[model samples]
Target: MADTGAAIELVGLTKRYPGDRQPSVDGVTLRVDAGETVVFVGPSGCGKSTTLKMINRLIEPSSGSVRINGEDVTGLDPVELRRGIGYAIQSSGLFPHLTVAQNIALVPRMAGWSGRRVRARVTEMLELVGLDPGEFRDRYPRRLSGGQQQRVGVARALAADPPVLLMDEPFGAVDPVTRGHLQDELLRLQRELRKTIVFVTHDVDEAIKLGDRIAVLGERSRIAQFDTPEAILAHPADAFVSGFVGSGAALKRLDLTRLRDLGVPGCPTAHQGEPLPQVRARLRASATDEMLLLDRRGRPVRWLRRADLTHAEGPLTEAGTPVGGTVTRDATLREALEAVLTDSTGRVAVTGPNGVYAGAVRLEGLLGTVRGLLAADRGRAREHQRERESTRPEPTPPEAEGATAGRAEGDAMGSAG
Candidate 1:
């Protein structure tokens, strides 16, 4: 179950409808490895949905093939194939008439599982999606909130333990807060389940957050670029990919990027009750202009400038004098950037959830991470270019004059006749 491998593959896939001058999807070829999540992203009407639907035969392809688990699924019965794969949509699509358990059990029941097995599976799925089975199983969709219904949608999709999951904007219908929660939940689930997931979304942020790899779709369903989220964000293929990724890509990079990559040295720190001279001495020892003041419990309180020590303040025990912004250690690079921008000091205090001083992040460290990311991206690009050049067919050398003479004479005689 762990190593199913290449759960879905599309080779030269194209789909065209009647009277259409252009194909909806033109020769799309991509593969999704088992236990990996790939997100297809593009502007409206870019044929991403059509490409996904073709995988389960929801929309038949005009040509080419769709294979699941190394088997060509294009010829398989569409209904049976879909039943074995998990499918979730924007609106949850739960049946209001049925209880939550019944809605979740729909697929298992359709597959002719015994009622006891179906019930057990339904209960498991409900728990998996963060809904208590005892409470939500008997409740109808109408009794749940938008977020709740979407959770139910995910539960129903996983009811039969499908190895492949197809999600088409599954959280699109929920509010921003709920959408974020659902995204985190899905990430947690994916970490545990390791299902091969194909998630389609137009949100670049979401794509960067959830996708192990991203397929950037362009007009006519052409794949502009396919790579890991970090690579895609760092090095977009063209103007379309760049614009689609949006203006704040550098800042967004922080969200996907981590702080550990940035080599940040420790800054001088002092407790609140420390003498002013001692604080000044620590600041001078660190060769820095300011010192971070920590509370009695060694939690960050505020920053103290060297000049402030010159005043009559007996100690640097100031309660709250321009502490600046603080961020958690796990906060994305993007959030750190925002904190730096909003604060005047261009520095952010890193603290744990329990309010313990973890470390500090300065503009220098942040810049270093960005540079490292960009450098790695450029290296990859050069390698890809080299690969393409080496793989390209070389031209044949010119032949001797007599080599094609007979063929040329025959062609001339045929044309004359």
Candidate 2:
């Protein structure tokens, strides 16, 4: 199956139910590029779920356009449209009577794949979702845990290799720890599969962590704001957006990237044969009271303070303070911050998978990265606002041109400054 991600576009999309005073989803226009995972987030009763269902024609729109890869799919038969797109809902949605293999093979079977091909596809998808086909192929749905069942639902959705996937709070039924595990699994699969995904969730942090971009909705399903998580967190579109972001928005954005991605600096280190003056230079140059002492194989010995930098002027040894806690490269900035705060020394030591020292990060470095991200986000928001204002159809009075120019110039200077 050709499963390349397809771009989805919705234009003037509106949905109104019978006897309703207003449409559930107003005229909302948005485009999702190929391979992009867009999260729709808002309060309950918002049109986010309605919007997601419309993509696969689960819920027919009152009037609007739904296009996939530039082809108008709004007119396509609902059943055919849905069969080609993957959909995963809140619960696992597995058939109680069907074994795991049969459940996963349902879609391919519908598509007229041969028995042998269906079996192979089922095995591939089960393994793709991290379930062992040998063990789980014949197990009934009731025999699996909530998380495992959700994985089966996901695998079943992909059995036919659909190009697009729609998920609606698919992890909502599990416990918090299980939900986190499922979320991580989805992230892992997304990296390998790159399916065009429309994910619906009410949690801002989840949206921020999972989405390449997010669409925040308001009353009647209108888009309150649509942008990347960083820009939205740094410069909310209005008071409504700010309030919805809740508290600690900065920390939420900080969680988006791990510590190693920031390229944190390593601590000054001396091997077993380094000169005394060299060790002293490194310690003083670092402006820290202690430095890392290494054994012959380049692992941390102990904290060698400037007071103990002499020590016979030979290779550094075991006479130093105990090292503080270590952090891994994959740890979030929140964890990195914790490590930095709790460390006895000023640095947060980083370790690789082999338990060998990789690098070190200082609190100041983390702060600097946060500041840089915030500044860039604000700048992007301001630039986008200006471009929107510039594109307005209203013509300015001739006399107002001077003021507009001045404002534009001032904005440019402000951006530069």
Candidate 3:
């Protein structure tokens, strides 16, 4: 599978049903940059799905062109074009009779990959989506949970390493908790793969969470506003866009920033198998009363307090309260805030790949970050207002026009003198 991310452009894309008075999608022109995730969000029946399918010619655009990476794909054979574009839909869309490995191998096989290569890709993709190839490869779809099935669906989509991925409410069928996990997984994958993604969903928050840019659609697939989540949240284009943004625009801004962007400071720490005397000495020297315990692999295990050290005659692993609240660096600020608020500790542990300890985020830091973000947004809004005012064409009053011209001429003469 090639590691490629392609730019997608739609020019005047329209879709009409036979004998219908209005087209389902009318003149939707959008550009999704390579390695960007662009989400299409709108009310139900707004033709977001129809517009998504037209990219692969599944719905077949009635007019306009679909270009991938610079080449026009509208004239290309639908089958070959689809082979290059990964599409995943709602409900996992897995063939129930087929095993997970078989389902994932479909695309690679269609491209004439050898059996060994297809098998290797199947294993690689499953692992890429956090599924164990040994455990899940041979299991039928019926044997898997909704979340597991969705992971397999994603694995299948990426098996051939398509440059572009089209996902239509792929996580909508799962429970809220599972949906969140899937969203987090997608973010992690995007960070690594950087594929161009066009995602369709009616959930505004989801769009804000996943998209690099969001296209808010209205009737007949009219794009009301297309911009970054921060821009749209700070300044909606119109009433329709504002209504779609709903309340909590400020909180939604938190999703635009990730924990990695903030410099998460490290706290005092101790390893599990360290000597009890050494651990006691370190804890006494530490500024804080608490220390984070890590396993041999450097993953967070427990939080040790100064008092717990006195009673610990044995291994440090069997000491202090178990570390409960944890978040990955890929987690958004909102998620980190939620974890910190729920935990008894004022801070939450941040981890990297394979649960390795990265750093920690404190409540005070998050509060300060949020305040800074709001202040910056306000500043940008003011600047945009100034720009608009400067560029605006002001109409001259009929009576004042002659006076204004005379005043301008006098000012010019005074400057010359």
Residue runs of model 3 more than 4 Å from their true location after superposition? 1-3, 391-398, 401-417
Candidate No. with top TM-score: 3
State the local distance difference test value for candidate 1: 0.82
lDDT of 1 by residue, 1-417 (tens): 222324788999999999999999999999898889999999989999999999888899999998887789876888988887889999999988999998998989998999999988988888788788898989989999999999999999888888899999999988976776677678767867888999999999888888999999999899999999877876788998988999976567656864434534567788877767777777777777776788887788877777776663665664336575676554556766777878776888876434568788888668777788767766877898899899998865467445577689989999999
Give lDDT tens digits, candidate 2, residues 31-97: 9988899999999998889989888887888999899988788778777788899999888899999
- In order of appearance, the predictions have TM-scores of 0.67, 0.69, 0.89
lDDT of 3 by residue, 127-147 (tens): 899888999999999999999
Provide the lDDT at 284 for model 1: 72
How high a TM-score does candidate 3 get? 0.89
The candidate scoring highest on lDDT is 3
For candidate 2, the per-residue lDDT at 8 reads: 92
The model with the greater TM-score, 1 or 2, is 2
Tell me how candidate 2 scores on lDDT. 0.82
